[model samples]
Target: MSCCAAGAEAALQMDGIQPVSADELRLASRDLGDGTRQTDLSVPGVHCGACIAAVEKTLSALPGVESARVNLSMKRVAVKWRALDETPPDLIGALDAIGYEAHLFSSATDEKDPELSRLIKALAVAGFSAMNIMLLSVSVWSGADAATRHAFHLISAALALPAVAYSGRIFYLSAWSVLRRGRTNMDVPISIGVSLAVGLSLYETYYNAPHAYFDAATSLLFFLLIGRTLDHVMRERARSAVAGLARLSPAGTTIIAEGGERRYVPIAEIQPGAMMLIAAGDRIPVDGVVVQGASELDCSLVTGESAPLRIGVGAKVQAGLMNLTGPLTIEATTRSENSFLAEMVRMMEAAEGGRARYRRLADRAAALYSPVVHTLALLTLIGWMVLTGDWHNSITIAIAVLIITCPCALGLAVPIVQVVAARRLFERGIMVKDGSALERLAEVDTVLFDKTGTLTLGTPRLINTGEIKPEALAIAAGMAAGSRHPMASAIASSTRRSTLEQRSFDAISEHPGLGIEARSGNDLYRLGRASWALDNGGDEADTDAVSISILAKNGRILARFAFEDSIRPGSLAAVNGLRQLGMSLGIISGDRAPSVEAVASALVVDDFRAGLLPADKVAHIAKAGASGGKVLMVGDGLNDAPALASAYVSMAPATAADIGRNAADFVFLKDNLSAVKEAVDIAHRAKVLIRQNFALAIGYNAIAVPVAVFGYVTPLVAAVAMSLSSVIVVANAMRLRSPQAAPAPADTSAVSGVSLRTAAAKP
Candidate 1:
């Protein structure tokens, strides 16, 4: 069966699926019965506020549904209703009552109505016509003969009618909507102004009057359309993360039958309990438990983690994690629909497409401001006629005022900044998940850091060892070699430096929180806790991870390994810069207290936490957030998820785990916390640029609106000045396109896991 068919069956089997909170399941009246009949709805021709309100209001009036909400953002309706024995056809009939078609917006088809495409095309025509009309209007301003001026006036009106009715349809629809709502917004004045300008301009052309301003109205529509289209494009581009999830598995899987024969099959076709074999470096074909062998899996590619994890028999794996070890046979425990990984992918998709709370002050204003400008233009014409007694001159000045104040520059301010900020971040290997992150970053005042994986390198090294040497590590290394864990690999790597001919170690053992042990020769070897090694008695003062002792030919704790991982280059400078800028810093981690304190002390950070779980980290972050300062939390572990979410704006390393990245507001690549500090500084500067741009744009209008209204300025001249002012404001905002950060000081401490090579390169 197709995915659509499968989804339908699941809906049938379960209670019901409601896309939103209240939907086709509840009725307006208490008399409505169980409305569980599957409501398959597909809305083909829905647009404008009326269509949204009409569909929602009508569908909710159906016998079963009590309430309904239409997500105009998605063009989908959700219903609440009673459980019924009927099929979805009953709900379909009810939506038809509203004089519209309603069917499920099926996921199967790639078809989309050309409504937006048509809008763009119309907008382009209006814009092109407006520009040509503007050129002709300029001739009228340059002392042309009355006949020539009149000819251009008629030409301008000829181009404007189609522009207003087609390209500016939203202006009319929105104005009508507000009136129906018994409310008023910015669009009211704009629509009123445009209506008055066009009406009077056409009258002037027909009556052979001298003051038609058709060019002015068309210019306003053109610029507004440009701003609107740019905003739409920005939003569409920001939603690529959703598209990322959609393109995740190739829509298929490999299945093993009950008879144990394997065959490639569609991911949707796999059933629970089917065994499947996955090769090294291949994605697990299904979410399942390892029934056959062991391997190290790198789920981090999808999860945004750099480290690989070991999985053995009884271990569970997801479909996207790449297997890095030997082959493993997995038994499917849940069908693809019920898999945990699948649920994660679905949730991420849903979140990306919904409820981001993306609002810019400019957008909110534009959405309402257009109508207000229209109304003002109408009122202005009436005032001029009443005051001046020259109807032709009064109407021309009103057209100039409308053209000069379309709010296009005002609308473009925030969106342009949003796009530029996102683009700058992308250039520097950062992905800001959504607009809210940037908004919060602009106001952040404090930063909370995760000590282990964020500020300090997550990789631990043997910083300095005492007397234990190569022979002492034989059993330890041999046993660890058999294991696939990170610590095992670390120890094995260190042991490989010894050129000693190795012997097979037997009876290898591991104690989860303690350590591991194995036997290589007659001389016994001990490699674990101080107590465990010292029972046979050896020195135990060293705190190194690879510390050891021996029961050998010459028994001694000889040559303990001295290992060190350095801090990332420029780390100190970044921290110092943030502090100098008056932000407080704190660190939290799940590592041992000594380990946490060691790095914290090196950096001179006053506050730090060790051994915190995900919830504990969140609590700490909430505590910081509630303290009346904007806070930035940074971490790259699963344990950091909640804390990251709770902060004003949190950053994650590119290597962060899936949950970490998901919870974080910003993601930093190159795994340098210094970049976090730099980004914050950039955000502060961008906010400043935004303020300057707004002041400039608003200032231009404040000066020009009155001049245009007083008839000291012609419509053509006003259009030129207004368009120039907007361009200047945009240019001022573009100043934030560059970043400025002092190069960070190199870290010299080898306690952290950063490389010394970068530190040495520092001037």
Candidate 2:
């Protein structure tokens, strides 16, 4: 996405860095010589340099606190001070008072990002003073009187002091640190710039030798800091989604007991076999069976399908899902850890924390540019000094080098692009959970899809019927109503059988890998395979007329009902679209070959593997991935979890099993195969915008830096150019919203009901 926004798309924008007072500068520094304690605090939400100043300024004013340096991009605060007589909670509270939520970072070697705000602020102040100082000196060029000059010099000195103490402090400290380490960073040139200007200005002010370059030092600081803040803000926006997901789950759940009892019970405290009563609109407490009452539950969280499902007695429900209708009582069958919702949350957390194959472009750039910029700054200083014998002129040239090459634009390049592109993606209902998943998606060349819920109407339907009494259909519906089979359950629902006598048939037995059987009166009822019922071998010729054959008490056929899973409406189109995108598509299904092949043909899949266990799916994905092509696995069943994880990037519809959905890097709420195309297209568009932004930023700097170096550009002019460059980048990225130039991904067909949208649709 472009880093700049056009007129209608403008949002909050960043200004150049403005340094605070010496008192503020002191907040960022401390004398570790006093045997003070040190602590590293991490706040994942810190967005800009202003946040840094807010945290530092508040802590610095505290009685025993020494110094605090807050890294805006890293969201880290480094503090050094004598042990607080106050407790850790008090210290945490202190941080909280400044709008910062902090947690103590436990790592002994916590890495700190070099704060860009410091440079941006320094540049802002330096630019402002540079203009004012130039205006004041112009009058002095015409022979001002003693007091006129004294007053002018005094004003100049006053302006220079804050710049030196606040914005310039980091440069000085960095120079000192690098000096000690036998190396130099970009700060080395900055330190030289400020030191020369202020030192020479002080000499002139004290001894009345024309004028000093105090203005130059301050101007340099301001420009650099502005660029820095823009970079930080963009990155914060990019990560907002994952952070928002983290906040969705509550820290604890409220459980009710007898006599209106209530307490804060941690999620982990929930155990299986507990009778949990949930009120309307409350999150389901844990995975459990509906033991009392009935309610409509919103399983959007579990399936990504945006529909509310009705849950009645004997139905299974899970935690994190909201009860949208009436209150219900549940007999918990699994602990919180085993609940589907918990598994989704766990999956998201793992995906967020797991290391992707590639790092982000911005981080990689920062890593390489830091040392290079510092080296280039050093070279600029030496080159300028060689060309100019006068130290004052050389310092001015060196400061210009530092100001122009601050790495602010370079830092803003990647993050700004990602933020715009990601926000656009969120609006389209495709969530890329892993920040790095987009890069992986761009590289995907092979796609593996799960059959049951992925490519076909995972739900079953009554397709045909033969010689079955209405009463017999009602009885079968009532008996199979509570089953979990994809077929029997749906066929059982083709009638209103709720009023059927609740009979406990004798000899009730469910063959684990097969179907159910029972005895009522003198009738031995069989409800699965035709062969199982007739006590004969399964025949392919007869399989063509596949139907459920219910037997009567006297070996007569009570009824024959045909059930078939419909292919999703757009599944064929989606398969075709992926093929157009140069992806190889195939299917792995747990269902038998006949069912799997039938659905695959509808989708026009080239290859199909049937009766796959979860491990088999994983092995297929793994084998495909081993060929060096990124594999995107789309699935919804529990059996597809491993395949989802092993693929380069995975996606699942909201109705997918919790573990499978969690394992996926992306989740499509609407569940049409079209989302895959839409998401990938969006990612590709984002990459283009990012590249455009990179060019705009690099080109602007290419021209602007030379102007600043040659002294042809004033501080005010530089700020305007920098701001305009930023606006352009953001505007470029926001263009993703226009559908005509960037058309929506095409959907190939609507022949079946594969969209999770259909699943979520009310009956």
Candidate 3:
């Protein structure tokens, strides 16, 4: 029977599938902050580039949908849509109409993969049957008598029938699913080839012919299943980072009630301001502040730091951190859905845009592959029939042509390499927000860095505190207490042990890119840049030593306060590594010229710009790109967000402001500057592998197809060839995980005049 006829007899019952209510969908969706809502759905049937294009195109045409994207590696679809009269889009129904079954996305990891289990079972049956049939065929090949050979052929037929029925269903069902919806995928040709081979073997067996192909039919199923199983396993390994993060969150936490009673509640029920008691060995359940106790925390998983962090009252802790030393009571600051762990998982699973260059070409090729293979097989059959005048021989060769030309290798080329590269970066504490960013990073020719908070630690310290009078220090510290700037923080912290009386200001305000101004009972006090604090022009030329902020009272300088920020660990190494790779490096900052120049000279970078506002940074990045240079911007501050978004590619540290982190293409958790060079190196290697994979895939078809068309290969040989091609591509991608693939740069442990601490204390 035809596959469609068989499917009709076992069609899915609509009532068995529960529909998600609109209210439930609304609650699950996230607001995109642009009058649109984004909903994610899991479609297990999506496995290739064609499926990605089809699903995205179908959903994007819906009434309220502004955009739709499919993540092939995750088998999920994200749709952004505007609400119409407060109604949610019917995403599940639209997918069902196109012969796909979808449901609301859940972060819960499945204990077992049903598809992988089924593939393994199918492989076992096919392998057992193939060995047994090959044994029977050997006896026939040795010239057994007519009656014995006939009986053996009948027995082989019996064994092959059950094996094909059980093992071949994997391909048959997938082929039928897409065929019924007026589409074709790689599986269509596979199903046709296997069925024809089996049918011809059965016919020759019943007629007592001299030759039969029962061994060929069973061996084909065995090899195809092997390839499918390995592909599934490798893909799973590439995406394990996201799954590992999901497993870190606890199901419930002990919430302390207002009346001093404690009860275990689900993570979702813990709200903002709720007091939760965390045990000494439990993972933190939410992003919150430690309100009552002191303890050491194991923050390796969250921040990629191996050392335990010491926390006390008012210290902020993020979710996924492990409490190691003492029990603590903390007030929750954000819901579990908005926690840091959840955000990382979301970023890792984000889909690449449909317009990415290589992805687009691959989709087009997959879409056109099925029809081209079908046409070639049809023409081969007609030409062979005319040349040989034997229908059996012609049909067999055509089946060989179909099986040999399968595009499995082409389909796995780009995505598998991308997944492997993403996993590699994830292991080093770097998160890639988009897969295509790696492709772009490989093309960068210039690297631009922000000065404060980026090249330097941005946490300045008071170096001239002992040189100034005690009363002057007291006044500066009191005025600095209200500001959060790194300079102000330094002053306040340095005077923690002073015995002077507290000084209060009637009014104080901080100006961006400048300093702080205060009014103290008709005595004007300024604590900031010299030019802005004093009216004598401040002799700007004399303020070239370090970062200097003047304390002026009534237009007279009371004290000169000098500060210095620690150079970030590995800055010298990162600069040298990038320079060795032949990239042009520069510094762009809002700091004074002296500070920027000092850092630039230390790193040996010649192109430097300072005293620029946020807009100026953006304009510089734009002009660089416009001049034909692909720029990689590295920054960490609220003011750096726009520049990060404007650059060709950007990276930010984990301590960067929320907006800046969100705008960056990559975020590194550790404080080391080496991550920038590491990312660039890995990207270059990944690009090389992707190109090699494409070549191997195209080159395989170029050689194998003609041999099958001319009757030089059999169905069994075609299966083995196709399977090996895919395995070769996968094995090449696996090389990325090897130690020799991406080697570490030379060690700089003894580099002079730089702090080697990888983690800094929170300010």
Candidate 4:
């Protein structure tokens, strides 16, 4: 909601514009599934809530458009529409008709911000003029004679005219653009006031009057430009997180052709199934699985962890991970546009949208603000004229009213805080899917966590490997290597058999929840549940039991293996922190009751449910929310996706299943559970600051507007007051950037539970 020159440069450059063809528009759009597509356009003229309302209203009314959302921080609009009879909607033409020049948005980080440079240059001119004019005005104010006062006024006029002409175009062009479209904006009143002040000063000087307001006119532009410049700079600072992330993507990658020749391929041209040759020091360009060689990757950008991860053939890797150790060849799984990096950028941009209730209120107020200010200014002029018959004083008072009641502060109240909070969350390795999620998170009083991936790391370790024979462990590892189940991963990592010693399995298959089954030299092998592998005609024993996995050959048990899911780092501190904040904690998990109970007791959470399906988890969340408390769900499995969506506000680990991660409102990239408490702390503080901003804006208006209308405030003073309020609001939102301590742990001595260390112990 900055009153800055957001789109003025685009308006100035809109000469001989042409409509974008439907084919071109279609080429730039993304297929969102279900016959719908999304097209993002960079609209440089959009800076405030009213501009957002105007553009979205115009675009949403088009033939096939389903929705249009404006991200003011990015100065972009995303339009979702269905093709009507194989034709794309005329989005570009519609925007042009409404006075906003637009083109397809490019996520490249190198684009320059023309409006910011223009503001800075214009500010320089206005500042120089204001200083010189103030020096001349001092002689006139110090009781100079008629001839001397007139001479100083003429010199002031010479300095002020060119400065207003140069520095004032930012508002003039913006006002003209909207006015010609039969609409009014915040800039309309500003343009009128500045114009009238300069005009009246020229008229008085011609009549040899004792005073002229050339100083007021030039100084007004200077102060207004200061606010505009600061607003633009602060907003760009807030959007730095997304820009920094975009810079990590390489421009292109080395592609290995079919004939074994390597060639450079641009990232956008790298298609699925293309073989990419990644060097030892290069960043991964797309999501892929390793096909040859091995490497250690610095996955800090993706996972928020500083440690290096080792990957070999068959290991899945995402884009933005730094390959630190050795060269590797990988087959791309998705195009650059659909890669994990692109998705993360989109999510971050979405977090800046004006979807929150507070922003909606601010927009509605701004939409109605311009007309009300016009009426108030006109009434003040008429009142003064009827009272004193002096047209000069009356017009000057009207100009003051216009400059004082600009509503810049009111427009900025909500969005500034949202941008600052989003930036803070991003710095902490948390991605907020929507800005409104922060508002909902602030109201949460109860927190429910999933057992496996949410509270624990979801990676289990084979702790009882000493009890199994080497031959039996090797056979189990061979079968386990083919499955992605947690226990299978544990078995594969714990027993490292050489390629020659590894048993060759003729066939291998996995039974969803049961386990892995394989065949080697006509001998059958099963590495899963005892009941399922032994083919016993009885109920499943693994549902309520501990983590004892059985290895059987030809229906006889060879060795019994056990695993333990390590507690996520900071789980104790996280649980204690949430409790310190007066939150009620519980566990809802799909794990065996014994495992879930062990983790729950260690974390000191009393309310627990285990062995529940996905639907049961959703029902539990729904039931908890029905009791007049907002429930925050934290989980990381495919089974938790439904529950994540059903909760009031949900969070997930970066290692979560794709479905669960997408469903959650917040995604924490770090392995530590401490991010949960950190996000909550930020949300609560943001809510408080937003309230404070609203109060400051309203309080300023309540005191300043009446003084201007009564002629006690001049146009110069009014301009200073308006701009200062905006700066105050921005400065208040910036308080969130200060470092906040992680919530301290609550006392756990009175709670009865298993020891966390023993439960996650490694042999």
Highest-scoring model, TM-score: 4
lDDT of 3 by residue, 305-403 (tens): 789998877678988899999999999998898888877887777623324567677677877878999999999999999999999999999999988
Order of candidates by TM-score, top first? 4, 3, 2, 1
TM-score of each candidate?
Answer: 0.66, 0.71, 0.90, 0.95
> Cα deviation in Å at residue 334, candidate 1?
11
State the weakest 10-residue window (summed lDDT) of model 2: 5-14
Per-residue alpha-carbon lDDT of model 4 for 464-518, expressed as tens digits?
Answer: 7788888998899888887777778778877653343556699998887677889
What C-alpha lDDT do the candidate models reach, one value each?
0.59, 0.59, 0.81, 0.85
TM-score of 1: 0.66
- Each candidate: how many clashes? 69, 47, 0, 2
Local lDDT at 109 for model 2: 24
Candidate 3's displacement at residue 684, Å, is 1.0
Provide the RMSD of all predictions against the true structure, rounded to 1 decimal.
9.6, 10.8, 4.3, 2.8
For 123-165, candidate 1 gives per-residue lDDT tens digits of: 7987888888879877987888888888888788878898888
Error of 3 at 624 (Å): 2.3
In candidate 3, where is summed lDDT lowest over 10 consecutive residues?
A: 1-10
lDDT rank, highest first?
A: 4, 3, 1, 2
